[model samples]
Target: MTDESPAFPPPPPPMGAPAAPPAATPALPWYRRRWWKFPAWAWLTAAVVLIAAGAAGGAKKDEDNASADTTVESVADAATTDAPPTATDAPTTEAATTTTVAPTTTRATTTTRATTTTTTSPPTTAAPQPIVFSGRGDDVVNLPDTDLMVATISHSGRSNFVIWALGFDLQETDLLVNVIGGYSGRVPVNMNADTMSLQVEADGDWTI
Candidate 1:
């Protein structure tokens, strides 16, 4: 027997000769390989379980996204819809204006009038003068023409006293007074007399 454990490497071939292959390692058995140690049924069940877990994870992600979108839509609707007004949104008003009125006073006026009196007197009138005619016995007297007048025929005699009148030519004649004792009476010398001549018959003086 030769020495089986040689410590030195193999010698190279000549410069032109092809190198020889390294020694081949011995192969392991199928049972000892890592890929074929378990049964086929275990692999088939594990593959099916892995596929199912992937599908379930995808479906759960989709459900979560849809729930989140629905919650966001609900929040948006609550924010945009109608609502009652608050105290801060109400309108403000100013205070009312105040006015004062003044009172008025009235005064009355009075008027006075003065009265005066005047005295008046009537004018003085003088008495008319008496006409005088005197005769002692029967006589004829021409009487002056006069206006309508009333005169007293006065005789101062105890015997008969007579007064008569005559016209211008002594044709018209009339008896005026015939008296016995002292006589004082009145007679009217009017238009019919016409200032005629008068005849007086007396025992004493006679005047008119």
Candidate 2:
């Protein structure tokens, strides 16, 4: 007998044997498979892309934050450098000047003058001259001297008449003389020592 495997194969797997697993469905490539299905490479590739994107974003954000920090620091430094300096107390200087004045002197001069005086002598007056006369008669008579005359009567004549005659003649000489006579007509007459001699005359028994 030729042992020929029965035509169709051994009897189909017994019903009890776990039915051959349903033919495994062919795995589709990642691009052609349903969206829910994924291969290891596909998941790995997606995970790598996401990780790279997150890293890139984080780097950009850090750079931005760094630039902001640099800008703030630069602004603060600039403000410090540009601020004005503080004031200090310093002393000021001043100059002093002096002036002088001169004094003036004056001199005075004196002058003297002389005066003259003249003395004059008083005028001399002439001396009086002496008078002399002699005569005798009973009637009135006259006796003459240099510039004077004397007259007398013995007949009781008024004395005024004798004085009038002497005064009238002697006025020019400016001399004084005195005479004496008797009380009644009969008595004799006499003359003062300083007088010119008196002349006498007799009229009847009386001397004039």
Candidate 3:
């Protein structure tokens, strides 16, 4: 016999086993693939992007609110603006009142019991310069000290009001006004005030 060995038949497969290999999983379409089958890192990245977008929107909303607040404050300031009420500011118009005294005249009587009549004239006096203060609404205006002052009040509105002229101790001076509507009048300030000011309660524009 030659040195070649004879081949035997293969052994039988295990009982109940299938003859073919298992089938491969079916592939999904491109659109449906990433819906639920995405990896852990991909889902985390998507969540991060959503959170960043929300934060950016919130920040923009806060900035818009701040800008609105600033606009409101600016409008409020303009509505109640007040003019300068310093005591030193004076009007440019000048008014001078001049008085002349005539010489005494002596006349002889023509009729009987002739007598000479002599008339004497009083001394002339000059009027003081006027200090003017003007503004709208209610305010306390400071004034410079003066030996004598005439307060000429002029109101444009028809509402009745009163003004109190305070002395250096904040007490009511002799000068005051009580009237209604648009009025133009003057009051002599008798009481002297080292620190003088006017307390006004009125409506509409006024000048003094």
How many steric overlaps are in each model, in order? 0, 9, 1
Best-to-worst order by TM-score is 1, 3, 2
Model 1: ten consecutive residues of lowest lDDT: 1-10
Candidate with top lDDT is 1
Which stretch of 10 consecutive residues in model 2 shows the poorest summed lDDT? Answer: 185-194
Whole-structure CA lDDT of model 3: 0.76
lDDT (Cα, tens digit) per residue for candidate 3, span 52-90: 999999999999999999999888887667545558856
Candidate 2 lDDT, 1-208, residue by residue in tens: 3322333443467876876654444454556556555667878999999999999999999999999999999999999999999888688777677777777777777776766777787888886553323233332234344442332333333332222122234322222222334333222222332233332333223332
Question: Each model's C-alpha lDDT?
Answer: 0.77, 0.47, 0.76
RMSD of 2: 33.6
TM-score of each: 0.38, 0.27, 0.36
Cα lDDT, model 2, residue 41 = 88
The list of candidate 1 runs beyond 4 A from truth reads: 1-125, 170-174, 191-193
Q: List residue ranges in candidate 2 displaced over 4 A.
A: 1-33, 88-208
| Candidate 2 local Cα displacement, residue 179, angstroms | 99
